[model samples]
Target: MVKELDEKIGALPDHVGWRLWRASRAWQAEFSAAMRAAGHAWFSEARAGLLGHIPRNGTRQSALIERSATSKQAVQQLLDGLEAEGVLERFPDPRDGRGKLVRYTRKGLDALRDGDRIKLEIERDYIDRIGRERFAALMDALRSLDAGPADASEEASVPE
Candidate 1:
């Protein structure tokens, strides 16, 4: 078992993972609030997160499942909910007759304009909260982490 972290630090024993999780939740919360204010009444953090993974032109449902790095059931449920809410719809994939393509509905496309506006507003607010350089560095760091898929056996090359 890992030893308890030094109490003075005021963080969990697995500080790095905890910090990342905390930060992600905070950012998602802020985004969700902004989305709700932008008149997307069907918006939830999970729905919004899945929506972010989708491309404007749309993609195969299987591709979305892969891109979101989540279970098929979870992705399907989210898609169904969004479809019921009229935010998105599913269509037959042209190239792959066996697969389905998911895309935003016309109403969804209209709301996407508001979503785009809200994203910039939220990004600007984040930049104001944590300076432009720091925010840029944070995004760069995250992108670096996300750039490649890593196996569980490979430890992240976190340099000293």
Candidate 2:
């Protein structure tokens, strides 16, 4: 059985990383196409992720790095683009003299709403293709993978 499992693994065309990359790219393409069809040319996966992380109340630019799980430079670049597109604005933090708080403008809020709608459409499409039960199971599996051992040094819990 172990040798059969090894053979199966070896026969796979791509490893986990490659599969994940392909999946992410495919999802991003669908998301981008949906946004374009909705007349939102500027909408992108990065922007959507960033928008999801920012609270309605707003968030500090420095805080976004951790929240977005990205570098400060990358966050700054995204913020600059969003600002240029009139989606968001950065202003000095009231409590912190040097810190900047990023708040969604009216346009930003509208775009965020549109993104949410697009996301729902995409989810529904997936459910339709895979069925509700399969979709739910897929999401649960993904969540479990995400919740794997917190420390990299520790072994992940694999289900039998």
Candidate 3:
């Protein structure tokens, strides 16, 4: 298994996708430690990521599904958990009678504020380890990578 893994990775030393995947895992581990230290023992990274996708005011279920790039069932499951925790509430959309809008409750907003603070602390630690310049460059690179082709007609250019 080790030889096979080495062979696969050695052949794609410049593969950004694989490297990003590894980085994401590492970051999540660090984030979890930070959250634990911050006294949020029940913190769920999945829940946090899903909630981060939601706007403060409210967003339609369909819009959330699109933004989260998650299956309807998966989103619904997360919503149910959050609602049970009093972190979120779902109500009928005022404009669209047929659709539902999901919004954060006061408790949820407070939790979000705390999360933001914790995230900043973690970021500072990361910046200290990586240096401000490298951290800034990493952030810029992440933003660029995140801004993929805006439309179907636009394609990402790949290096040969």
Q: Using lDDT, rank the candidates from best to worst.
A: 2, 1, 3
Give the alpha carbon lDDT tens digit for every residue of 57-150 in model 1.
8888999999899999999999999999998999888888899999988878877888778778878988999999999998888877765566
Among all windows of 10 consecutive residues in model 3, the one with the lowest summed lDDT is: 151-160
Clashes of each: 0, 0, 0
Which residue pairs in model 3 clash with each other? none
lDDT of 3 by residue, 45-128 (tens): 898779878987878988999999999999999999989888899999889899999998988887777778877887899999
Candidate 2 structure quality by residue, lDDT tens digits, 21-104: 898898888988888788777778788788777887789888888978998888889989989989899999989989999999
Is candidate 2 or 3 superior in lDDT?
Answer: 2
How far residue 81's Cα lies from its native spot in candidate 2, in Å, is: 1.5
Better structure of 1 and 2 per TM-score: 2
lDDT of 1 at 115: 79
Please report the TM-score between candidate 1 and the true structure.
0.73
Model 2 stretches astray by more than 4 angstroms: 1-13, 150-160
Candidate 3: residue 46 lDDT (0-100): 90
Off by over 4 Å in 3: 1-14, 36-42, 149-160
